[model samples]
Structure formats: C-alpha cells, structure tokens
Target: MIVSGVILLALVAVGGYGLLSGTDSEMAPVHRDPAPSSTASPRPETPSRPQVPRILPTSNPETFARRVAAALFTWDTGAGLMPLDYTSAILDVGDPSGTEQAGLAADIATYLPSREAWVQLRQYATTQYLTIDNIAVPDAWSEAVAQAQPGQLPPGAIAYTIDGVRHRDGIWNDVPQVLTAPVAFTVFLACPPDGDPCYLLRLSQLGSPLR
Candidate 1:
C-alpha cells in the first residue's frame, strides 16, 4: 500500500485531524401500497446480457492502483466489451462510492474511443498490457496537506508509471508495437482511518500523449 499507517499518522499529526471524520447520512424509507393481486403476472422474455470482462481482485492499495491502471489501458472490442463496459470494470476495481463513481464513469466515456469507433477498428483488434514501474506519494497530495485547514486532511494520492503495449493479431498485422512511451498516472484515493480498504477518488494521465 502506498499510504502506510505510519505515513498516514504523520500526515494527520501535521494536519491536526484524522482522515475519517466525515458524516454519513441515513437513507429515507419508502412506503408503497399492497399489490392489488396476489397472483403473479406472466413473465416477459429475458433480454440477452452483455458480455462483461472479468475483474481481478486486489489485496491492497498498491495492487488496486495497478489494477486500475491496467483496466484503463486494456480493452477488447471483439470480446463484446464496449467503452462503457470498460469504464464499469474500472469502477468495480476502484470501488468508489457516491457521485464520484458517476463522475469517473462520464470522464472515462469521454476519454476512450466510442463503441462505433471500436467496431470500425475491430479488424485491428488489439490487447494492451500495462506494467507498473513505481508508486509514490504525489507532490500534489503533500501540497494539499500543507494548505489544508485544521481538522482537514488532504486526500491521498499515488503516482505510478506504466509501460504499455498493443498486441495485434499476428496474421492481421506484421508485428506488435508499443502504443506509446512509458506514461505516468496520478490516482487519488480515499484513505479512511478505520482500516477499511481505500477507494479511488480520481484518476488522470500525467503528460501522456496516449489517451
């Protein structure tokens, strides 16, 4: 994990606040009238389900970060995974909550190629692999902590480099090629003091021409 307990404690000591101090709201209950008929109606035909890609589990924050990076870099149009599906997979791996996940979903949809575009490029079906180079606390996180008021701690963030490549079908293409040079990415994560798993708060490519 990028944010170890000792570092988190040091950060809190400097900021004069704990990481998990936010309040949570209770959901309101909904009431509905009893059904008019106890008997069930005829069932409708079930629609075919979309083929969603598998999501791997991560044991810690660093593993989760790597998984998120890999998910963002890899896609397969021929496997019936669309842009939305890809983003959904990332959301699953990150395990974010509230409107944050919705915002990320929208951002990813806008950033990646559209379904139609992917279909058009199906002939060159490519699979991308991402290798994590390093993970460290980003300067932005430190700056935010320094500027935060008492009783407020900055959100945790980790910066990591990824080397990516696109492998095309050998028969369709002469040889596989690197998509672009190694790129760095910064991912913001919510670190609760209660020892719960950290969730991704935001993601951005750092000076990477690809995507």
Candidate 2:
C-alpha cells in the first residue's frame, strides 16, 4: 500500500493537501493549540451505549468510505469515551500494512477536538454527527490515475470526495442547543478487486476535497 511520488503530485494538483511529514508520506494533518483543562471527577460510562466497530467489514469501497466518513465525524463527549477511543475505531479499518497509520492518526487529530476541548464539551454534553449530502468519485481523480506510473497506486485504490453537513448538539446552561455547518473532504481507499475488504489510505485536508 505504498504511494509513489508521481501519484502524490497528482493528488496535490487535484486536492489542496498539505505536505505530509513525520512518516515520509505526502500529506500532513492540521495542528491545533491545546486548551487548558480543569480537574474534575471522572464521568461514568453509560450502560446502554452502543458498541462501535473497530474494524469495519465491507468489500465495497463506496460503502466503506461512507462508513469511515461517518465514524470520523460522529461522537458523544458525554459517553465517557475519549477522543482516542473514537480514533481507534477508524484506525482499525485503516491500511493493514501500517504504512499510513501514523499519517491517518494525524489526520484524525485535526477533526477531533483536543483532550481539553473534549473535557469542556463533556460539561455541556456535546455530541456530533455528520449528515452526508453526497459521495462521488472526483473527476480530478481520473486525471491522477491516468498520469500515475505503472503500479504506483495500491491495488483498487480510489478517491471519493464527500459533501456533508455536520450537526453538533449539546446542553448549554441547562438549555438544549444545536449547531450545524457544511463540511467536505476526500477519502482515499484501497478495495482489492479480488473482493478483499476496503482499507482507508490517506485523507485530504478538511474542506479542500477534489472536485
């Protein structure tokens, strides 16, 4: 599941992704400042909370991609689950070769709030979910594939740009509150043509997906 330099360049041309560092990849995750935290009692895990999948099982690339998108954006801060717990779920369905794990972790970090932010959100019982508007193969991807060197891309590698709305809910000062915003991004995946399950590769920068 190694991406060649040529394909990396093509992806850059199509999607405005930042240079990936730390693991010798081609895209980097956005960094955010850490928020200060206050000492507080630990929250209790709800007994009725539904179990989240670690490894999502699906051979269909589109289905896998949609699921991955949802998993990345959905979470409940008051469920006694930390950001890493949600991150683990997405990583479980990531590149099995572990080549892109570090990069993916960095990508996930940008989407999720920091530990201090999470704690503060918990006080308000903040929860978030994505309402997907559409998912399609970006036309620019065809150009990237056409220019890629032989065997440069992984088996069944594909890119899908997702358009969606993010909805955040919380109880603020004893009042229920909701916020919504539009979000878009591209998801790179490999679903071997032999019918093997799909695996997430890399993600484009948030809101800068290929057309």
Candidate 3:
C-alpha cells in the first residue's frame, strides 16, 4: 500500500511540470533612453525690448557748455538760441531740422551742463541732463525740467520734447528736401530747466508765426 501511494505522488508532480511547460514562454525586456540628461543647472533666455539712440558723451562738463555756445554762436544765455538755419522763415525759432539720424545722432555738447553749481544741472539725473536728442526712443520722453525747484533756473534755457515718426530717411532732418519721406509729427517745447518761466511752443506753431 505504501509503495502504491509513493508512485501516485510522483505521477502528480510530473503532470504539474508538463502543464506549465506547455504554456507560452515569456521574458521581461528592459529599455534605455536614446539620450542622456545632464545634472548641471540650466541657463535663462534674455528679454526683447525696443531699441534706443546712441549719443556720444560730452567728454567733460566744460566742453558741453562751449559747444552749445558755439553752435548757436552766442554767449548770451538770455536769447532764444537753438540749432538750425540762421536765416529763413523755417528757422526763426531755431532749426529743429539741424538734428539728424535719430538713431545714430547726438548733441552731447548741448545737453551737459558745465557749471553744475551755476546751472545746477544735477537737479536732474546725470543720464537725463546729458542726453542730446533721444530720437531712437519712439515713445515720448518725459521732461522733469518743468518740475525743477527754484534757484536751479538759469537766465535762458529751453526744453524741447520731440515726439514724431522717423520717416524712411527722416530720422535726422525734419525737412522734406533732405528726406523724401513724409514722417508726420506734432512735437512741442517747454521752458528751461533753469531760467525762463513756463513757456510752451509747438515746433510747427512757432516758426510760421515769426516768419
């Protein structure tokens, strides 16, 4: 009886092995990434903004004062002096057309104050006081000249805030003869940072009247 029991158990074990072997064979496969990643920190991208004009520096303070005096050809700060034609109805208030290439032009000489104590140009930021023609700035540039404190005013100073289009070739000159393109504008000027009281003059409004 014992021998018969042992034979039966061995037969059952053999049958179980045959059943699993008959089943479909299978194996788990591993996959690797095509490229490896670095553990180093990542870099950031820069922001894009509008461009501005590049005006040269006055070198020193005295050089600036001399240039403005020479350009207008007058030592008298009391008079209405500006750049442009000495004659012609178009230039009576001074030549706004004298400035050129809003993108590559400058009047560093006109803007910087020589006598910081007398002119008190320090009232405004150094960057503000030294910019000649901020033409590259398509948008309107603010004038803190109007908001200056007393004792800062000189005898005759004027602030021209220009806001207009840069025609195909009109960045520098406002006249059509120099430039064929018609860049329309409505720029205006206000009184000085130092001397005069609040006086306003539109570029178009002043010259035609004086003429």
Using TM-score as the measure, the top candidate is 2
lDDT of 3 by residue, 1-211 (tens): 1112211121111100000001111122344444434864544434332222211224232232223222222111112212122112112222233321121112212221233221221221111111222222122222323444452322232333222222111111222221121122212222344533322122222111111
Regions more than 4 Å wrong, model 1: 1-59, 93-96, 149-180, 206-211
Against the reference, the lDDT scores of all candidates come to 0.48, 0.75, 0.23
Candidate 1 C-alpha RMSD relative to the actual structure:
14.5
Full candidate order by lDDT, most accurate first: 2, 1, 3
Tell me each candidate's RMSD, in Å, in order: 14.5, 11.5, 39.4
- Model 2 C-alpha lDDT per residue in residues 48-140, reported as the tens digit of each score: 444665656899989998999989888877665787989888999888889888878877777787776776677777778899999999998
Query: Model 3: which residue pairs collide?
Result: 100-172, 101-172, 153-194, 154-194, 154-195, 157-192
- After aligning candidate 2 to the native by TM-score, how far in Å is the CA of 3 from where it should be? 4.5
Q: After superposition, how far is residue 204 of candidate 3 from its true place, in Å?
A: 1.7
Residue 141 shift from truth in candidate 1, angstroms: 2.0
Clashes of each: 0, 2, 6
Worst 10 residues of 1 by lDDT: 15-24
Model 3 regions lying over 4 Å from their true place: 1-46, 54-190, 193-201, 205-210
Q: Model 2: clashing residue pairs?
A: 20-26, 20-27
